[model samples]
Target chain A: MTNKHNPAALNTGRRPLRGAGINLFYLPAILILIVFTVWPLLSGIQLSFTNWDGYSPTKAFVGLSNYLTMFKDHNFGTVLVNTLIYGVGSTAIQQVIGLGLALLLNSRIKGRNIMRAIIYLPALVSAVIMGTMYYFVFQYQQGALNTLMVSLGLPRVVWFDKPAVSVAIIVIINSLQYVGTSMIIYLAGLQGMDHSVIEAADLDGAHGWKKFRNITLPLLMPAFSTSVVLNLIGGLKLFDVIQVLTGGGPGYSTNSVSTYIGLTYFSNQNAGYASAMGVVLFVIIAIATTLLNKGLDRLGWES
Target chain B: MTSAIRHAEAASRSTDTTGKGNGKGGRRIGHALAYLFLGAMIVAQLLPFWLALSAASKPSTDMSSTLVPRLHDIAWDNFTTAITQGGILTAVGNSVIVTVCSTVLVCICGAAAAYPLARRKTRGNKLVSAGIMSLMMVPPLSILVPLYTLMVNTGGVNTRWGIVLVTVAGNLPLAIFLYTAFIKAVPESIDEAGMIDGASRFMIFIRLILPLLKPVTATVVIMTSVGVWNEYALSNYLISDPGKQLIAPRVASFFAMQSSNLGVGAASALIAALPIVIVYLFLQRYFIAGIAAGAEK
Candidate 1:
């Protein structure tokens, strides 16, 4: 296949005269990206240095005050901690559960396809819808969960009273909803694995736990890496779930960076502070992603 | 001791003969365990949807009960009340108009924009691809202030077009990435064939390329539609007029109503989610595949 499609053969036959035509097709995408994406990002950096309330026509420069205020703000610190806990905690759970499900489904099992479809249903539902649905499930009174506990002679629990627990519930719900996506990716990776290695391990008296740990797990690192990065980025930017489930309440326990920025800008009318928070979030995400990419590259998993 | 020795000898014999019987037995157990675990997971995942559907069907008073509704009672009434009293119909209309217009425009623009990036080999292609990739990492909050300013300056505030454009801008990066990936799969031979036949680039795109993009286009359409329909932040900020809000914002407003009409609120939530859910159920396979594709490099 490589010999038949040699670049030299193509180049000898046809000089590249289609550059103008190609540029015509490419220009719009570049234009749109600059106008909408690149411009906003630069403006966000500029805004972070100003004292512009969202409604103000003219803005005064505040230098580094917004950044200093963010560091000093107690609520911002709490939200930062909350974001880390939610991101790491949810990513870990989803990775474990999703990989387990993928391995289970990859085996020769009846109804595997149907089970895959069923498990994936949640990913298709809107985050807002899921939040609304879970809200009723966790409500103090008239909630199905509380009713079930009472009927079973167990004490009723207030799911939202404790901020930490409510945030945990939000993380769990979001993680579960997205597990199917990572599971499928893992399944694809598992399917692409060479079976002869497992057979050889079996011949060497390795079975079950030994085979998985020594062979299968190491081979599935690419999928693991992909799932982790995707989940981490997603968890960092979570908004709709919190908005729907708890509305950043029982007093800001479940507020994430995304929601904090939203409220700061829209509700508090502090655009400059919000932009500072946004810039901070962007820098953190960029550093995290860069480290992850470098780590993956060192492991030679890019392919 | 004699019986144990006999059993050991029998196991050795079975192993020496390829262990087909043992393998079958072990596989059966594994299958059963897999099914059990998957069944439990599926049930847990579907519980919220079941609860939502049941609550939507029951009257507000009955919804608070522990028992599940045996049959849907307030179906038509809830829907009608949600539309009239809750003003969900207007929201739905706004959502549809915005979603449809934006989706069509994005499809056209995204495909056109992605074509060169997919086919051409140039130094700029790498930069373009990286730029699009990095765009995905930007949190919506990063641009909320500037985008809001842009909308206001352009007279887009409080208009359907404002929300629509925002949605388009937000979704375009991902759509272009997906389209480019799929477009690469279209054989260069087809393009050569079209060019040899003296077809103009425009004709080639419309006649040759567009038809071949059905699957990816379907994926993009369904994804963007669901996204636009369920969008809240942009609509919340941009559409302040009660008459101009979309489904999600309407649901929010219904929840915040001073009267506290839980029945109508629940009904509105149900209505907002039903279209996406039904579409999803029908296109589960494509939706799953599309998500997986989007996640892939």
Candidate 2:
């Protein structure tokens, strides 16, 4: 029945279904994107220059005042720094731990499948819930840590008393929750590797650490980039965990730009300033993503 | 492949023959250390959930360490209270509606969008594709203020369809990227065959391409469902009404209100996490594969 369709045999040839009409298939998606994402993004930029208090209909054009105010705002500086720390700290830690776990599980370990499942479990759970669960370890009253301290006849230590300590806890929790993502990525990369190359290197007296550094490490570059970028973006946009754990408390000391924006808009009612901060966050992520991609591409080329 | 394995086995055998005596003790110590490290990591990873379980089972008056489990006096009321007072079931229902609606829209729109982009490489289509892909990098919070305003003006705030549209838009970029990649791999000859059969482009897409999209659709569905189900940033503000709020925001708010009642808080958190955990356990293979595929984009 299929052979009966020989219309193309008489003609020179028919190209692979090329037409302007088919482009309409993307219309629905493009319309949704335009309305929901692109339009909002553009309007956010426009709102950055206004002095709207998020509720009032009337607004005055404030020019670059919002952007200028952001520069002088000491709290914004702290939030920006925290954002970077969360992004870089989590990315670095996740790579080390994720790769280590992946390597360990890849080896001939007992019950590795279960281990993999367990390690990856939290990555699937909502970060808000994970943060609440982890709060048990650091909660002030009857916390796991405080309970142990009292049992050992020590003073009750406040876990989130200081800003730095709180920030560090957030980083660790975020990293631990999502390290499974990186581990799975690297595991896939390792499994898909050209084992023949490893075998050849092995035949040439390359063993263990030497083999891993020269052969395996370079081969895992693609996975490294994917995991790093994903983790980095996730960390930079860290919201739920911080919201649940501290709610950007301690006088905004632990706020990332994300949490700061929410506070500014909802709590502070500084919609214009929050919009400016949103623009800044977007620009920062854009620059970071571009620079990291370029750097990774160079590394890939060199290796 | 067989020969590669044979060579790998032979290579290991040779390494064993040459370095057996010198490295035997060191290898044993290394294995032991590896196991120790992994065991400790396993504990660290499981500690939170274990403690949550313990806390949920204990009474609110039990201010003992969450590390301690109540073997005899289990607080059954905590779970019931979370379900009844915490509005967890309502939140779960809200999440289900939003997640299902968003996932379906994403899969349909994404697959439809990818067909033309993958088939026709027109300059306009290429630019459109790039533009759509770039939206993936625009963090949702970055556009929250204006999006919230838009939702309010349009009466989309506190509505299930509103949240669904926003989530679908947020997730469609990645879904379209994945679907486009998958469809590009599918032989163009298939489309040509449909064309030769005098089938319309839509007919070819509906009849031929859609069936082959099953695997990628699974990846998209899993990704979008998990994302929308657990979404906090957008949904937190967009659906501020308690009845319409999704799981993450609802649970967070409930936990905050019940902060003193650790038992109820723990129960609510566990209830929110249970559905995803059960799904993951049952479809462990697909979850891992879906995430891996998502990351590849």
Candidate 3:
């Protein structure tokens, strides 16, 4: 309601027809979005109801059949469960580890900058490289891990043979690789905290665990929420690591929805069915993200 | 002001009493434990890179050895063979073209679009912002099939430009969101001053605004480049020609061709990763800042 002049806004008195010209700036962007994003999204929804092999022109419209087929598929069920576990587990691990690292690095440490750089190296590397590196590390015979285990007088475990363990390892590797980003976020939050409040707590004998729990943790909720949402979204959409490391294999144990969709669309050449799966995945993500955003709002994150 | 004085007093008191009793011993033990944990974590993180570097340097025959490679048997030929026989050079070139072009285009278009959204208080601003936000939530696979079909129909499939354009499009929402956030942080006063000096809007953006946005620009460039270079899924489906494939798809195909050449494959993979690793090492601060900004928003 304040009538303060905003220089960015056009002067209506001098430029009465500015609105029409101003609207022109939006055309190129809107056109690109429609062509590249919105149209494809709408087309994908349409394709979900049809029975179209990727190549053939002839198609049959099948309502909800593809969705029904996905429901009945055992692999789909397993993959859904896997995606949830991976999402929750990775988010938890990454947040905790990243928070700890951020706190440690926040304090005075020797060569902190160098350590920060080294820790962040993995995130910058392509998922393919990270997966390949892990593949060698988890190789059955000549793996570095097996060698280390042998030296430590522990049994050489075949990582990929067991489904759950293989999936967990993949999640751990991916989470660790990305922890640096979360750590940086937490570091920023820490930097922005009111230092005076922390000092007051210190004066009241809030030291160590008490100080951390009462002062540090509560103030760091924004970072926690952000990290949690990001890690969850990332975990659900995980593809590159799984693709390179196991190819959704050791018998589809590590398969995610993204990988499944890729296999169905590209390898199986069932575009319509894949589109249906994609829609389902999209709905799930949208719902989860909405819930999270609501929760964050309640926690005053938007402020 | 009182808090600062209190903090100083507390620090002095703590230091004055630091040499008391068995607390020093306890603190030393705690420090040792912290160092021990940190060292182990560092080793865990660095071990893979160490292994890759050592293995790449070792002769092919020595690759299967249980022991770590000796410094003497470093097979420098692996680098040459990786480029020549492994066909990594062409893949590297393809990756460079795709990453560089996509990143530049995304940055330009994203910034241009973001300027209006960030600066103007128009009727559709909120709607536009929400639309872009929702676009970020849409899973990549949801539109993959349709996009592929569209590309094939439009004669965009199997071309470098095709890959670049798609990557740019896919990345637009996030890029615009980040750019809007960054541009908002720059005050409108600068624009007013430029206008008072009789500068055009485009001139103001290019001269005043763009220079100040170097940090965000570096962050976006690094992120987008790494993403484009390492992307396997899009390249796998789009580029059928092996010669035109980027580094990731090339690695996948190379591994498929000769599983026994794990050493060479690993080496080639390392070679592909080196540029990003180098960039990350130099611009790590900006990378972290960009991520922190994105997450915070």
Alpha-carbon shift of residue B41 in model 2 (angstroms): 1.4
Sort every candidate by DockQ, greatest first: 2, 3, 1
TM-score of chain B of 3: 0.83
Interface RMSD value for candidate 3, one decimal? 4.6
DockQ for candidate 3, please give it: 0.40
lDDT of 1 by residue, A1-303 (tens): 553356565545452325447658656656766776688889999999999998868999999999999889988998898888778888899998899899988878788888888777777666776677766677666678888988899988989879888888988998988898889889877887776655555555555654576567777877787888888888888878887777788776779988898899988999999999989999888888889878976774432
Tell me the lDDT of candidate 3.
0.77
Candidate 2 chain B has its poorest 10 consecutive residues by lDDT at B13-22
Q: Of the pair 2 and 3, which is ahead by TM-score?
A: 2
lDDT per residue for candidate 1 within B52-136, as digits (tens), equals: 6666666655636423743835555666787887788788788889999989977888898778878885777868777887887
Tell me the deviation in Å of residue B1 in model 3: 15
lDDT of 2 by residue, A1-303 (tens): 554477656123444467678889999999999999999999999999999899998989999999999889999999999999999999999999999999999988779999999999999899999999998888877688888899999998988878999999999999999999999999999998887777787676767775677678878999999999999999998999999999987888899999999999999999999999999999988888888988997897675
Candidate rank order under TM-score: 2, 3, 1
Interface RMSD of each: 6.8, 3.1, 4.6
Q: What ranges in model 1 sit over 4 Å off?
A: A1-17, A152-155, A194-206, A300-303, B1-36, B63-67, B70-76, B185-198, B258-261
Superposed by TM-score, candidate 3 places the C-alpha of residue B122 at a distance from the truth, in angstroms, of 2.4
lDDT of 3 by residue, B28-137 (tens): 88778877766666776777787777667766566463237658767878778788887888998999989989999888887877777778766688688779778877
Model 2 lDDT tens row, B118-150: 989889889999999888889888998999999
Which CAPRI tier for candidate 1? Answer: acceptable
